[model samples]
Target: MQFLPQAPTDRHTTLEDLQGIVTGVTMVALSVQFLQAAELITGQIAGLSLVASYPTGLSFGLVFFLLNLPFYVFAILQIGWRFTLRTFLAVALLSALVELMPRAFSLSGVHPGAAAVLAGISAGVGLLVLFRHGATLGGVGILALWLQDRTTLRAGQVQLGFDLVVFTLALFLLPLATVLWSLLGAVILNVIILTNHRRDRYIASS
Candidate 1:
């Protein structure tokens, strides 16, 4: 008897994939808490929330979650339900996690220089995980992906352009040295995304 070979299939997400998204967003939230404690901001929605929170005395978690709401419609229409739902969950969980992170640990001994670099590393790694899992932390990421699909530009480029605007705002709100370090963190985050998140290289459902 001849045996039949298996047909090609699109790999679906496993339980592990779901868990990774949660873990990744948690890392990102923790990183945001670090940035907040240092009174530094990075870029994109996270940075925007940071800037707003500093002035308004509102919670960054609340601001971040609210800021991401308008983009979910675009996200669903462009990326599909799985991606959108995962993004929503990640964003919501991140919002909650950020609130909890400060209470969970003390940052008194942490230096600004170290906090900035660690924030970048943790954020970059977390975002890398989210991207591979076919999800995002939402906000500008959804807009960037939508714009990239419509234009000749790459998503990374669109994100970087927006990040520059966020950093410029940081200049007014934070000390010059702090903004410079924040820029460094932004660069590290972009380097991670641009280098590792290639579509042709990593094929997964999105």
Candidate 2:
């Protein structure tokens, strides 16, 4: 039996690997900064990380990593080893970036509305890179796309539904208006993913 290749692209060359790590780190950091600046929440593990960060004083990066651990097992069992490894490495890079961002940059008085827009765009772009690479940042997103393959539901809609639940929980922790901002962020984020992440649009003719 011939086994498939590990990844779509070669994983060698320091520059190529570094590119994925850098892209993942930068985008995840941007998303966290935007979320904190906006005082808003997102969906799935990232939202949970925001919620956990409130009490633990743990960085959102750390929280995000912890929350995604179990999901890696799910990914391995449901998807495959190669996907799981790529996702694990991507999440690790993102988590490290999140922890280091405070030292790298600061957000003093960012307005919620502005932060929402930036955060959405940053996250959308960041995840877009991972998806294009056949890797992921993990969490409900991984499951959403998996389900989309088996069911007739659109992946974006599935992700949106999950985001709703995550933001709904935000209502309890934040003011109603802040939760609204998060919802706006989610909408913008999803729109970017749907419009830009199409296989036909992203894939190059080899």
Candidate 3:
């Protein structure tokens, strides 16, 4: 009988990892600032949360935080408790930052097209940072991570599909021009993840 070598355990995140999470989330909050400034939307749960909060008196941060609640089970079960907890922390950090960003900063004359592009790029980089550190922002990502764990599928592909569905729903919630611009952002965002976040590419370090 041939014996297989055991897989090495991943090292726990360090203080630098936590700082990276903060920095990444701050960038995401900056992206959200642009999105709200233009009254535009992108794909993923963030878009859904924006749509849900549009007519209501509730805040975007609250809606976004609540929207992610359902994915914890998948995160914990498939990705492990550490990942789940880190994700929850990331989501909470994103939520707080989204709310705080508007108060701390504002932009004038930001075109919707520019907003979409900037928001997509900023959020993509932000998410990449989280992904590298073994975390996510919850929602479709949790599902993507779980699916990636169980199958040969790449998490980015799974995320792209979910992003498309959310963008389709954006049609009903936003203007045609806004949705079109958002589509561009979604494509950019998905492309970033698909190109950079492959399971085969992001090897674990000791």
Per lDDT, what order, best first? 3, 1, 2
Ranked by TM-score, the better of candidates 1 and 3 is 3
Q: Which residue pairs come into collision in candidate 3?
A: none
Cα deviation of 200 in candidate 3 (Å)? 2.7
Question: Which lDDT tens digits does candidate 2 get at residues 1-206?
Answer: 97543433333454555576568557867888878876677777888888788767887877788889888888888888977787888889888887778888889788888888888889878876776555677898788667865777655777788898888778788789988988888888888877776543443211
Q: Tens digit of lDDT per residue, candidate 1, span 1-206?
A: 97554442455457767888988998898788778778888899989988899889999989989999998998888778988998899998998888887777867666778888889889988988887777788987887666766777766677778899988877877889988988888888877777776655665543
lDDT of each: 0.82, 0.76, 0.82
Worst 10 residues of 2 by lDDT: 197-206
Tell how far residue 112 is off in model 3, in angstroms.
0.8
Q: Give the TM-score of candidate 1.
A: 0.88
Better of 1 and 2 by TM-score: 1
